[model samples]
Target chain A: MSLLNDLTGAPPGLPPHALLLRLAAIGAVLAGTTCGFAYVGGWLSPGALTPARVIDRFEQVNGPHPGFRRNHAKGLCVEGRFAASGAGAALSKAGLFAAGRVTPVAGRLALAGGQPYAADAEATVRSLALRFTLPDGEEWRTGMNDIPVFPVRTPEAFYEQLLAAKPDLATGKPDPARLNGFFAAHPESAKAAALIKARTVTAGFADSTYRSLNAFRLVAADGRDTPVRFAFVPERAPSPETAGQAVQQDKNYLFDALAAELRQDALRWHLVATLGRPGDPTADATQPWPADRETADLGTLALTGSTPEAPGNCRDVNFDPLVLPLGIAPSDDPLLSARSAAYSQSFTRRAGEDKTPSAVAGAPPHGAAL
Target chain B: MTPSPRFNLPARLLHWSMAALILAMLLIGVAMVTSLADYHALVSLHRPLGILILVLALLRLANRRRHAPPPLPADLPMWQRRAAHASHVALYALMLAMPLVGWAMLSAARYPVALAGPLVLPPILPQSPVLYAGLRSVHTVLAYALFGLILAHLGAALLHALIRQDGVFSSMAPWRPRRAAPTLRPEG
Candidate 1:
């Protein structure tokens, strides 16, 4: 029996090569497992900005207001329909752009800030987010801002800007030196900021021209794609009342005006697409396409009613910018994925928090005719 | 009492197959959290594989109940025997709990548990962000625990096979060794 055990190379006394092989196998497994744990634990990859970290920074800067969006926390939901003109069919085959094709839309109009109750005069940025539920059930969601160009080209730059803009403890305002340092480091951001400062803030959400800052591709039947940037150009001209002076009386002036406007009459905006040329910048949102680029009027969006955001309302929706239909695809812009990730993270965080009923007064509850 | 010399074929088969599935699951789980480029692909794989693990673990539990594994050598220390049994219980618990927690987490987040095209499992819990967050943290913590337990299990198996040269390792081993030595060292 002992001779047979020796011949079969039994353990308790492994041959040198066999022992080495076994030890090496064990070592390899341990090393791989260690690396895997490190990677999953975020130790192996240091300084890598993840979606979680981005959301964390947002909460840090804004302070958490549970159950509300980390940004664009103040908003009232609107229901609308998009009436497509056949003119857009030439550029792309999206069903929403077919002649007289009307798609149901759930949307939100909001001022750009983390504070849900910030006074209207304090908000310079306005946002129009929409979700068009197509005939076949695929949804095309887009979140557009009033600015003609994005303030930052990439998410990292946006993070840097957030840090620089954080309120200093010594003074409630952002440190001017840090803000200047950020702008100096990112010239593109400085230029975009200058351009934004140059434009007059619209009196309210109804008159503001909300632009899809990022470029998207419109795919044709033959598989050809045309890079395009779009904007919702409001039919209503700026109200006679200037935003800062007229809305200062009400804290929820922007939402109040929007709700009142929708109550009296339907608000309308034309979906205009700017066809990009070969030399146009598709990835960088900060760079605007030339003014002379051909523009196509896709259709009109007629918002019929408003609803306060609640569980079953548009409040549950993430309004992820990357949720495109079959005919539209995201550009190679890095911000697209970054935005999607951050939005998903934000949605997850808010979805778990205590549900806060929409504070909009006199608006119908969720699902009440809106 | 003297026990059977080796585990039944069903136990061995389940053991080896589950070993492979679990190792793959751990690696895929790690990869899913780390890579955004392949996130969708990994998720598709993850959801199905997680369900499969759950089902196999159930079968494993049933098989274990029906067929008791071969006993350790009588000379083995009482503390080691208790530890071996406790770790095995822990392994089984995690195997069952991990998939269920993951399913509950997705359900809480209102994400469909798609088994295949057009086939989805119904939500096991209501949509609540607090519940989702809590379950998600538990899932992550349990995953690390499972991985650590597996490592310790592997180390113990190696110890038995190489150092103890006892039949404990060969009992559940897929293939039989050439020589059938019941206990190479009585001291062990």
Candidate 2:
């Protein structure tokens, strides 16, 4: 009787308590259906609400050359220029550059890979580098990753991370010795390294949520700053007990499943930034921000739109942290600062096609966000 | 008694394998560039392989031209034939264009493109910051363009393999089943 009253939109004759229960049930059913379908199909389908709908969904994302990439190589011949922006203007005249946002940004993200085409299941943590030009014409970079605390800290350590993961000198195999150095040198990395190692040996994609162990400084309009780290909490749950058993059966389980999920629903991360405050733990890229310091909910990050399905898996979409808008800036944590330059160099090296950003690179003061 | 004008084994291997590699390359390229720098060596391998694909794609195209493709299926629609022709042209055009643009962009930026050996590829574009930045974006823009074209290519290939089940797929089939081989292989 109470359930019946809660439904029917709670007519004046119905008791308030009864009406409330009915409404709650209906809401629960509707949400459950969406969640169920989300697992089946929503994860892969790129809706108008998709996180990365960078192209023509809303008017805000739309810009002068909506889908254009500024041609640096072409401008080399014609405009005597190398800037992506300048190339865009020149190409627009020649009917070359297509419509895209004027203030272009670039981003790159990746995980540590040992074999050239090794299955992603192997312990591979993620990386993101973004670069954006501000309204004031200044550029800011934000370098981040999926692990909450990085195994290496300073630029020197970052360099060592490269050597540790590099090919062996004698046998041309991945050097196991150097790879173990950081783990041995800093016991703190044992925690980060353990998480990384389990990812390789484990199987459940649901129970596994990755983190960027580095801290970033986000400056707000009120002159307040927040030191933050990134984590991508999985939307679905997989049995932790079965995670190991599943890995033996399927090596590429996480990647393959994620690919299917992407086909259904856009992967979304609630961009929550942990603030460094008097009440919070030290906010340093070298130190893992405690779970308790979780502060502002930055925004939601999702696959906006993929012209081709599984873009990061199947397209040329680079998701570097350096690709930024106006306000977001990278901090002075030596690793974050070095990544900006390193990424730009790596990106330029990776792309053999066309265009370079700027020859003269600059870094801002990192004590706080700009 | 006649050999099908189908691509020679090496040509076919290069064709189909490279098609797979290039597509994989693009995706891996996309993902690698977006990453925060966990594996620099893997990231390092991306470019050399891209340039390698560029070279291999060129050689593959040249071989494709040298040895004519098997005659079009009698039932191939007129539109598909034209599309087939145009798509091949575009594929070759992109395969050739993308690397050069990358090389030129690199040249403009003053970076040496190591072409898988001690020898370095010559910089096609002179050093100019204004030109370098523009070419780099153009390089990236072309990268996206290459991606779009590759998607179209994939759709066509999948259609031929799954829907048509025609000889069209044989051009790049990893191992064309001998006429006597049974079709009991499990699905992907």
Candidate 3:
């Protein structure tokens, strides 16, 4: 029989044994083709840039330092205790909320971007990242920002935003033409910009509210689940004297203000969890839940003490959102995983830098946090 | 007299409909990845269109099983005949696998497989980023392979029509004569 007969499933008149052999050959070909295609797409093809490369692009524009993060590089480290109220047990079984359990929390308050000495008075996003270590060795880490909504929905868009924000080398200023084009193309970002423009800038970190922005899942003991977002709303009233005040001229005014306030009184924030209803936009962190969504006050976070310098306890730690204790899981928000991946890449590169000793001090006092 | 060479009416209709849908899907898929401005809108169209293609593919498969395809010309070279048969099997396999992998990828990513608002398909795979990444790569590679095959199929159809003037091109064409032509080109 000809090759055509064998390929077309042993055409009429072929022997039974020959037909079986031809069938086997066809199967082999299909399997081989699939393997070949997978190998090429997954590894061989030069496409889908890695997270490390994306982080590198940012470092290229903003020169890298020996001990600074790709974003939120300038920060003050604080050591405190985060006592969980057992009230959260009804919503999630995470061990940290086992009522009255005080976890030694190490945290950092930083300005967004890679500039280690960026002025505190400049218009920028402020981040509050914390790590809570349980007795059983499990840790829950979270990095939150003051903004209610993130600028972009996906990691790819975030990388593009970084590229657009990079300052032109010759001018030493961010090119307006590039930023205008990016904003026009990605209109979802306008919501974040509008929020920044309309809001009254707070006086200090203690009074500012920080939002997790991404939705996460809370599983109960009965295996029931609820989607929720978290926020740290300050318990203290907005200082009447500082609210809506003109930008301070001193470069270290916010940090100095926080240190003075902490000395006089303890800082506290109500940890509130907002429950997501059906049809809530959980996938996109760029969108906020409806105003009428149900919410529960999970607990209170009290910052009782402050340090003069960057605390060594939190310096090496990365507050990856994916590092959660039992009963808490990441929602389908793509940004959650994207953040973890980018954070991991940043951690690895910085850790690598640490291996090579440089003239920079081994530990710079966590840059001025209370 | 021998019957006029052509696929059944049902088969012909399915072929044309699927051809149009698949081409449009390829274009939309490319546009979705390359441009973020149109990604959301293109994705909305892509999900429903994928389901439509899958349904048509299944219907076409069942029709093929019930109705015998017109035989290849007896005079065609053995290698060409083999190439034709192999490509047909590859095409059918890709048509069935593309939508399935797409649905599976979304399921792995913990995303709802919604065809339209309030019409969501149940998850076919457990949620895992590793699994999702693997399936996503497979889906993309399979798409490129399917596209190449479609182009080859179209080229072969045109060759039969313009160069060989063979009945093969007209076998699945929308219009076919009621009677066989008296001066038929015999197989080599």
**What tens digits encode model 3's per-residue C-alpha lDDT throughout A44-77?**
4446655656677779867867556788876666
- For all the predictions, what are the DockQ values? 0.15, 0.02, 0.02
Tens digit of per-residue lDDT, candidate 2, span A36-79: 43443225443412112211122121122211221110000000
Candidate 2 ranges with C-alpha deviation above 4 Å? A1-110, A114-116, A126-144, A165-208, A238-252, A278-284, A304-318, A353-370, B1-188
**Ranking, TM-score, top scorer first:** 1, 3, 2
lDDT for each candidate structure: 0.80, 0.47, 0.71
Candidate 2 residue B148 C-alpha distance from true site, Å? 43
In order, the candidates keep a fraction of the true contacts of: 0.14, 0.02, 0.00
Off by over 4 Å in 1: A1-28, A83-102, A134-137, A167-173, A238-244, A355-359, A362-370, B1-127, B149-188
Alpha-carbon deviation at A114 in model 3, angstroms: 0.7
- What's the true lDDT of residue A367 in model 3? 50
Among all windows of 10 consecutive residues in model 2 chain A, the one with the lowest summed lDDT is A73-82
Under CAPRI classification, how is model 2 graded? Answer: incorrect
In model 2, what is the error at residue A231, expressed in angstroms? 2.8
What does candidate 3's lDDT look like per residue over B11-100, in tens digits?
999999898888778767654543323434566687789988889899999999988788787767788899999999999999989999
User: Which candidate wins on TM-score?
Assistant: 1
TM-score of each: 0.75, 0.39, 0.56
RMSD in angstroms, all models? 6.3, 27.7, 13.7
Name the 10 consecutive residues with the lowest summed lDDT in model 1 chain A: A1-10
